[model samples]
Target: MTESAPTPQPDGLDVYVITYDEEGHEERLLPSEVTDAVVERSRDFGINKGSWTIDRIKHGPLIAAESQLRLVNVGSLARAIAGNYYGTALIVDQTPPPIDEDVYDIDRRYDVDVVDDVLVAVVTQRHPAQPAETEAEIAARLARIAAAYGCRIVGVSFALPGGGTPEEMLSHWPEGEEWSERFRAETIETLAGMAHDVKVSIATDDNVTMATLMDGAAAMADYLSATQTGPLDAAGVLNLLRGGHFNLLIGEAESGYLEVKTQMHPISAPGDTGKKAKVELAQDVARFANGDVDAVLVIGYKEAPGGANTIGSLTPVADSILNTAQIHELLDARIVPPVDGLIIEKFVVTATDSVLAIYVPKQPSEMQPYLVHGAIAEGKVEGAFFSIVRRRGEGSITTSAQQIHAYIVAGKRYLRGND
Candidate 1:
C-alpha cells in the first residue's frame, strides 16, 4: 500500500458576486439584490457571495453590538447595495420609529430589502450616491439616528471598496497628523474586521462576535502595534497562508460539538477588492443524510485586532450537523458530481400502496443541477424525486409513483435535446 501526494482540487467553490455594468463593460459594483441572494445561498449552502449576497429575500438581518450602532447601520446599507445587483436598495434602521414609505417604495422598485425599526429607505436603480451623499455623512447620520432610536449598533459585513478608498470615504477623516497615508491603510483593516465579524456570526454562534468586542481595547492595541501594512496586506498574507504558507490548524469547540481542525485566511468577498480574509477550516464531522455524504466541512476564521501568528478571534464553530430533518423535503438523486459531467436519471419508488415516479435524470450529472435549478425556479421541488407526506388515515409514508403520460411527453423532449 502507498499514499499519493496531495494535489490541489479546490476544496470547494467560493461563489462571490460581481457588480453589473453596461452591455460590454466590466462589472465593478454589484447591485443590492444580487448581493442578497448571494448571502442567502451562503447561509443555505455554505458559500460566500460578494460582500453581501442573497437579495432574493426581502431583508437580510444583521445583528450588531450596542456600542457599534453607527457603523452597523452603514454596513447594512452597504450589504443591501452590494447584493441588489440591480440599482435598487431598501434600508431599514429598526431603532427609529417613523415608517418610511418612500424608502420602502424605492427598495421594492429595485427588488431590494432594507428594513430596520422605523427608518426604511428604498432606493431605485441609479448611480451610487448620485446627488453626492458622502460616506461620512451617511455614517454619522446613521449613528445619530441609531442613538436617537435607542439602539446600539456595531459590526458590519458585505462588500466595500478596498480600504474604503472612494473619494467620499477619504473626505470624511478628521483633521489630524498625516491622516491620508494612515486613512488608506486603516480603512481596509476596519472593513476587513467588519466582514470578519459578519462571517464569524453567521458561521458560528451570534455571541462570538460580541465577545470579541469586549476585547476591543486590547484588540485595537495589538492591531495598531502590528507591522502589517493593514487589512489589504493581511488579505495577501492570508492567501499566502492558503498556499501551504503555514502548516497548522487552530480553534476551539462549538457550544456542544467536538472541536474541529481549522485554517484562516483574509479573502475578500466576491468582486470587492477589500482585504477581508476568508477563513477556511476542516471539520471532523461528515454530513450524511441517508448513509450518503451531502456536505463537506470547512472552518471559517476571522483576524483578531493585532494578533498575528496566533489564533486571532475564534468564531464559534457551527455544529457540523446535517439538515436531515428536511431530507424528506429534498429531491433525492444518485447523480454524479456536477464537476464530473455525468448523466442523470429520473424515476420513482414504492413502499406502501402509493407509487411515486420521480423525474430523475437518465444521467447522473444532469440530475443535481436540474433539481437545483428547478427548486430555484419553482420553489417546490419538481420532477421525479422522493417526497414524504402524511396521507388521510395513512400516517406518514414515503411513496413513489409514475405518471406515464406526462413522463413520456417530457421524456421525448429530453431525448430530443440529447439527440
Candidate 2:
C-alpha cells in the first residue's frame, strides 16, 4: 500500500493508478502481479491514456493538482471554454488547493465499498461543521476516479429531503433546469470515454444516503433497490470479471456469461470421467463462443444439484486438479474448428488452494454456432456425436432442429443455381 508511483512529468496532466486488490480472502491472497502506480499524460482525457483508480484521485495531494483534479473542456464547458469541445488542455497550468494529509484521512469525508462487484463510493460532506463542497466538485472527482479505474459505468446518488425519481428529484432541486439540461449531461459527455457510461441516480424518501450514520451496505441496498434492478449486461459482466468481485464465481449463483463448476473434470483419471470431462469442457466453451460477449467458466465452486442451480461455497482445488494444456487439448479434440482467444488462468487463493478460470471471448460470425464433437449418453461416452448449445441468462440449452433446418435452407438459397 505504501508503494510510490512514477512522478508526474512536466507539460502533461498527471494521472495515477493504485495497484491494490481489496479482496477479503481469509488469508491475504497474493496477487500474481504487482503493477506499481504510475503518473502519465493523455491526449485530451485521462481515461484513454492511463489506468487509474478513484481512491488516489481523491486522497493523494498534488503539486499542481498533485492530489486533486482540475477538469477543463468538459460537457458544455468545452463549448464554454476551448481546444475540441470534448478534450482538456494539454498542460497542468491551474493552481491546486492545498490540503492536510492527516486531516483528510482522520476527518469524516468519504467512504468506498464494493457492492455486488460494483464500486459504491460516497462523498459525505453535507454538514455545516465540515467545509462546503465546490461546484460540481464531487462529479469531477468521480470522472478522474473512474478514468483511473477504467470502470465501464459510473454513478452518483444524492438523497435529499424528498428525493425520488430523476424527474421528481430534479423538480426538488434548487437549479434543476440549469443542472439537467446542461451541466449534468455536460459532465457525462465530458467524461465520456473515461468510463463507458456515467450518470447520476436519485434516491430520496429515506435517510440511507447517510453512509457514515448507518451500515453502508444497508444504505446502499435501500438507495439502489429503488433505481435499478435489471439483468446483467456485457458491461456488468465485464466489471464482475475485472473488479476483485469473485463472490459470485465462487460462492454465488450463475448469470449471463458466467458458469461455475464445483470441481474440475478428472481428465487425467482413468475411466469415463476423463471422456465426460472432455465433452463438458467442449460444450461449455462452445456455448460461450456462440454468445455476444466474453464469458468465464470458474472451476472450484459447488453449485446446487438441480432446479435453480444456485452456486455456493468455495471448493478451491489443488493446482494439479485442472491443467490448462489438457483443457485446450480437450477443446481442440472435441469442438469443431475450435474457439479462438481462450484465456485459461489459475489464481492462488492461498498458499495451497487455487481456482481455475476459463475466459471464452466472443467469436466472429464466420465461426457462428460452434459445435461440440462428442456427447454423453446412458452413463457412457459417445465420441461421434456433435451438438450445438447456447447460453440463455444463467442456463444453457441445445439449438432446436427447426433452427438448423432454417439455416440449411438459407444456405441453399444463397447457393441457388450451383446445384
| Count of clashing residue pairs in every prediction | 71, 9
Candidate 2, 1-419: lDDT as tens digits: 69899864323222221222345221111111112221222112221123321122232211122232322111211111122222222211123333233334322222332233332333332221211233255455334223322221245443332233233433443455765666656543433322111123211111122221112222232222221333443334334434333442332457766777877877777777877877877888888888887777878778766657666566788886767787787787777777888878776766876778888887897678788888776767788777889999888899888987887887788789576
Worst 10 residues of 1 by lDDT: 278-287
TM-score of each: 0.17, 0.47
lDDT of 1 by residue, 1-419 (tens): 89999853322213223443445442433223453333322211111323322222234432221222222233323343333324333222333322333332211221112333212322122222222234344334334223322232332222232333234454566546575668766764554344211100011111222222222222222222221232212223223223221211132111111121233222223532111121010001111111111211223333434534333332432232212222212223222122121111111111211111111112332222221211111333233432222112111122224543455577799999999
Residue 313 deviation, candidate 2, in Å? 2.5
Which ranges in model 2 have alpha carbons more than 4 Å from their true place?
1-244, 248-253, 304-309, 400-405, 417-419
* Clashes (candidate 1): 71
**lDDT values, one for every candidate:** 0.26, 0.48
